[model samples]
Target: MRFNDVIMALLVIVIILMIIIPVPLGWLDFFLALNISLALTILVLSMFVKETLEFSVFPSILLITTLFRLALNISTTRYILSDGKAGEVIDAFGNFVVGGNAIVGFIIFLIIVLIQFLVITKGSERVSEVAARFTLDAMPGKQMAIDADLNSGLITENDAKERRKKIQREADFYGAMDGASKFVKGDAIAGIIITVINILAGFMLGAFTMGYTLSQSIQKFTLLTVGDGLVSQIPALMISVATGIIVTRAASESNLGTDVLSQLFAQSKVLYIVGGVLMLIGIATPLPNLPFITIGIAIMLSALRLTQDKKELEEQAEFESEQEEERDNNDIRKPENIIPLLQVDPIELEFGYGIIPLADPNQGGDLFDRLVMIRRQIALEMGIVVPMIRLRDNIQLDSSEYLIKIKGNDIARGTIVFDHYLAMSPGVVEGEIEGIDTIEPAFGLPAKWIRSEDREKAELLGYTVVDPSSVISTHLTEVIKKHSHELINREDVKQLIENIKESNSALVEELMPNLMSLGDIQKVLSNLLKEFVSVRDLVTILETLADYARSTRDVNILTEYVRQRLSRQLSRTYFPFGKAKVVTLEQSLENMLMEAIEQNENGTFLSIDPMTSQNIVASLAQEVRKLIQMGEQAIVVTAPIVRFYFKRMTEQSIPELVVLSYNEIESDIDIQSAGMVSI
Candidate 1:
């Protein structure tokens, strides 16, 4: 063990040994002085520390000090009754400090005990109890605040962890302080009982056995008993006061003295009022004039000085403010100052004045909160973080029109009527309800705007009903999903790699920079998202890339391999039912497309004739329209190699069409060929 640890262990043992061992009067005096000094140090240290957690070990200190004081009391009591003397420290306090009057010394000791037990210790216990309870009660809120700050990028992960630790320490410190105050209370009661025992025992031994007169015995024993009590009670009183100070102190950036002075003298007006009150009393009352009048004049002079200082401080502040404004004006004129303006948000939803209430939280508009939830929802569904969205009002648009933009380019626009609900038929409606004719902004389905009164009736008539805010929110969600591929950047892909690296480091290290770059990884993820595939299963995606990246660094081919590797997810997502209806390509057509695949420096491309491609597109559309008329999604299943090229060729004409490979579909789903594409 270290030397300091040895000393601490020996100190506690010695304190316990003191209660059982006899010591010389000189040693007793030294120990008594040490006790006083320790108590004083503790008191001062408590005042100097700005926060309570800085003295988290105070409860243990309180227990140790109380034990030391009790042991000292026992030693002095033994010496006083057995030898008629304890030590010079106690004797001096009895005679010099209390004027050798037993009655006066005893009264002083009792007063000290009463003050500590009744006022300081009692109040400290109550405050500690309440503080501990409140600290624990507020723990959840503090933790949530830290998490929110981390999510909002206001603080880093390390900062959040540190704050959470501090909160837990606060709860623990207050809990210990609550229990430690009991030691002070019990010590007060013990002090009283020990004093009584010493006096009574010393009197009996002196008068009966020590061969002293009754008056002498009473006087000698009384003085010695009062002195011992005084020495112990003084230290106990200081400790109790320290306990109260620590429990009541608020968190601050400065020591107690500085805080007290700054807060007490914060306002010159309050000081001036007090000075006037004192001056009036000194002049009007018949009480002592010189003392009160002298103090009153001093206070008034201090107040005058304080007021003059305030004026000078205000003038300095105003001058500094003007200088700062001048510097700001110059800074604005600098060309580099406009650099921050060049950066644009990844996504922005700019609405008109009529849509303000739908977006303003203060006006019961939940659009801001809806946006937050939308980010989380997309993260869960797409396995990619939706960047921070910017919401604002644009006056250039129609009053009800709102626009959604990606990378500063407008993508979609919609209109809303506040306080009105959009009603659409589910094709099972019993009857038609009278309403304003409209189209659903999200899916472009036929819809109607109905009054608040008609919302319930429209729903009863089997029509789907939604509010204006929901309409805008749904439209925005669809637009983001369609354009999420545009938002994936090198940084975002790096974050995903880092996230997956935490668990699958070997896979990430194998693929990144060695075989593929950040840009390559981002491109592969974008291609997956462009097809509405969830990258949430990033581990599987990365592992597959690591296996195939060595053969070819082409992102398009890598994405194709990743899609096949995520066959289960594809099956579960696209074919939730046990059956599927899909359009299939003819074997001859598949072979022709696979043979037409060509490689270049840019990547792979389909080299088929334009006329044949157009004829194939027309033929595929004609076949896929049969499923569309049957209320089925347009799906085309082909060989894995031909799926990519065919999807690219037909994407322009049918952007919503889902082109799948036979390898992408799970075996459990029985596929019925609804039609076939031929050229």
Candidate 2:
């Protein structure tokens, strides 16, 4: 129905018709040019494509172009035999390309055909077959590796599915290429046969049918035959070369041309040796002086240039390092330079030099990408925007050690074994695989630094295996979550409001500057975050604040109302099993906390004697331990009134324990009291 739908079909039909019907000289010349240009483009693409899958459709294109070349060959053959003229393209190749010398041109044509058929086509066929066989044979091992990564949580289920699909596509590509090589081989042989037939048939037809002499027949037919062979076989040679390149390409980040150039001239010392050897031969042996000496001089200059470039890069790195140290020293002389010291990165990951390659993208490290995903992960899970993390190398640290800093102070630190996998048992171990014992940084679980080769075995044995980068990333994510509340500021809060204002402008317009100031709202959100609660549901948080600010201006009181409003979300977050296992406070203790609660213009506080507060905390800790012993998180549920007071009293003693008001639990959730607390 549309032009694009049947454009390829129409081209195929035209090619077939060209083989049967006589082509005019003008159209034939155009087809000849098209053939050469298409072959050249294919050759260039083969060299530039970085991956085999990137050129997956190459086999199909090869077959179609091969058929098109054959159609042109047939059309040219008909014209050369019947009319004694093919086209201007063929005539020019006959006269200009080989100086009108039919013998030399014919020999060149034979060489090109033999080279394509015997060398490029045959080698490409063998390579394609080998690649296909190897891909199929290695399929099971690759599949197992994918499964191991997925089982170990190194990759997601979607990633495993994509890798499996890629493996299948690669196998199919190699198999198709293996068969396509035969077409090129066949095309080469056909070119030789057609050239011989053209020359023989043309010579006889000119001599007998036209009453021409030997010289006239020889001159007319020989030149045409040589030119036709040259034009057809040159393109065939290029296509065959392209096929060879495609089949032999290995996995690389760069194209074939860049890879070749980078690797070929990587070492200046090797070039120096080569240049010296060339000069020695020119001076000491019986060889021509001019060409050899000139080439040697050029090579030595190139080596010198390479050496200079390398030195400049080294100097640049050293100068930057020196400048950093010098700046620190210079800052001590000027007390006015305190501004630089006052500014701190929101988050910084400082690692040792041994881990540089893992952070350097030039060396194929994906640490940057992993950091980006970490931000996205937190955003999706906590509904908060994380600040950009800065990564730097600290030479003073141990080679394997790294530190996580928040606002210029170290919060957590860990070490990683580069080029090794960290494998930890998930409460199950079938067999013991030898490795260096250590602890996983994220959860402080007992783990091992195992060789990469043993990762599959570790995963199969019910161990969770993760690479060095994944280990660090997981650790960073946990630290961010633990201190997520501290990372947000007034600016971040304002941005959150601006985001909500896009769709529900009235809610934002009614909430901000009307009931609560920006500082009050920020403090409320921070308090919620300090309790490991998500401030992502900004609309509900804002609505609750708007409803309750008339009654109280205290952020702590406002936060409690917001938490009560987010009961459903909280219920799902902590009690996914539709039941809550928590430690409940005694009514007598709750009454004591309600009586001890004190308020000021600043905020609310729990005003109690130190000895009584310690006794209450000790009782609460005793009850929390009961829940923790049963593999449940430490949760304290109190009456809505004393919830804030109880949490304020016992926070220092049980920072990890969650304090929830009875009103914070959803109505549908069943409350399973794990233990009771009293003082």
Candidate 3:
């Protein structure tokens, strides 16, 4: 049998023997039977109504009620038998232990209950410890934001540091709150209730008079009536119950419900005056039982209601939070037309201090001191400072040859090309990447064919770490070059480049394998701008790449609309070309177009309709004047007789100027896109 079943069976057997053996053996048998019957009824009732035995204030109701009646019967019977002319009683063991044995058994029961109390209280402590750890871990990101803003000249640095310190203080505060929570947890409150009830019953029995006296009892029984002592105990009783209720309500997270419960159930100084009045009633009146029962029951019921209220409130709040999350998910917008950008790759860091004997994963203080010099060197290079060190767990070191085999077979053999640079971009910070040429021979290790562990070793050797993004552009460039053959036109390639230049990598991560679609690209950008705080350099890169990509494809009409809507952005500002150049490229192209338009008509021009010729000439002249003023590098016009192009003269020793179209006016067909512009 399980331990609980064994204990329970022993208790049942004890009660049964006490009731049965005394029945045929003595005059006090009825009283002994009453106590046994009460215990047996409780045990049996607990099987069906398991909650009555639960370690909560409600469970104390059943225990205290049953024990109170047991005390009353035992006291009454013992006094009658001992004071009267009855022979001594014999127990089931045939020992003449007298009428006092029943009281002895009750004392043993109290001891067993205390042991159970400790077990439940310890369990509460453990649960609260886990809760405190979770709250501490989740607060870091918020702390970092405040710190960054303060450091970037937007806010005072001291304020940011103070904010971080406040978060730590809050974590500690919650841990203390957990301790307070233990006082009101089920087991502690239940134990307190049982103790208070026993005190009340003891006071009444000792002070009240029912004309009862023990017959040949081991100790004399008092006929004391309920008196001033009941009054004195009332204050202490109120204090204990009020403490339990208030602490329980405060520790719970249900905001409004907890507040209401706390206000209603928690006692005020006014309640203490009322309690004092009840004490005086006990001092003057013989019938003190009603007041005790009323007060005790009131406190117990209040505790139960507060517990239930907290639970219900939490359930409602949890449901609301879940619904809010669902709505957020549904409202997520997918962009109809956008672009894709660069790809990101994860980089690993290798620590040089191979399996050190004294490393403590949870407490990195000693390790930080040991590695502080190197860390500071890297930090100086990177231009960053970290007040605390965070050490990762589960680092492994292997034999040199094993490292060589893994690096050679698994890493270098893979599809990634790495370049190594010592101390690359300065000191290492979290999320930084350093390039490595080959995975082999860093620490008796080589870049080629390195295993994962060996690659980690190389990181420890000379490599610095960088953000996953710092290398994304390089990776995308490689991908484009490899897949350029698949592109249908130069515009496609240009669009791809633009998208890469403008996209935010962290947002692109959401699109995953479907990043090729415009909708996915737009969704990523929207999600990124909405979700992330303090946009990093990576976010800037993604946005740039996206804009560039859209320009190349010209698929999203929104870009064109934006281009036209923002006149300043589209206005060409470059004027007379340069020092090494005779004229500005824009002026040269404009001059060329102008010369071509006039020259194409020949030195003398005529038209069958003189008015049509004048209109054509005038329109051409206005277009030329605007082209020069606007500073455009190129412009095309469709006309009746011929097409003209002003080609900028570059090869001839002639000044950088425009040339007329001696070439034919080709078929008037629409060319959809500008190929590529190299800057």
Task: Point to the candidate with the largest TM-score.
Answer: 2
Worst 10 residues of 3 by lDDT: 222-231
Which scores better on TM-score, 1 or 3? 1
What 10-residue stretch in candidate 2 is worst by lDDT? Answer: 147-156
- If both were scored by TM-score, which would come out higher, candidate 2 or candidate 3? 2
* lDDT (10s digit) by residue, model 2, range 1-679: 6887599899999999998888889999999999999999999999999989999999998899889989988999898888888889999999999889988898889889888888889999999999999898767657766674554345667889999999999999999999999999999989989999999999998898878797888888889988988888888899899999899998688899899999899899999999998998899989997788888888899999999999999999999999999998998889888777788999999999998888999998888888887887778667789999999999989999999999889999999987799888868689999999999988899999999888767766777777888888888988998888889888898898999999999988887798889999988888888888988888999999989998999888899999999999998988899886889988888888888888788877888899988888888778888888999988888999888777766777788878899899988999889888888
Candidate 1, residues 488-523, lDDT tens digits: the string is 898998998898899888888888789888888889
> How would you order the candidates by lDDT, starting with the best?
1, 2, 3
Candidate 1's C-alpha lDDT?
0.88
Please provide, for model 3 over 534-627, each residue's C-alpha lDDT reduced to its tens digit, 9 standing for 90 to 100.
Answer: 1123334344444555444322222222222322211221112211111112333334334444322222122124453344344434544455
RMSD of 2: 6.1
Please give the distance, in angstroms, between residue 321's alpha carbon in candidate 3 and its true position after superposition: 45
How much does candidate 3 score in TM-score?
0.24
How accurate locally, in lDDT, is each candidate?
A: 0.88, 0.88, 0.35
Q: What is the TM-score of each candidate against the true structure?
A: 0.61, 0.74, 0.24
**Residue 223 alpha-carbon offset, candidate 2, angstroms:** 5.5
lDDT of candidate 1 at residue 591, scale 0 to 100? 91
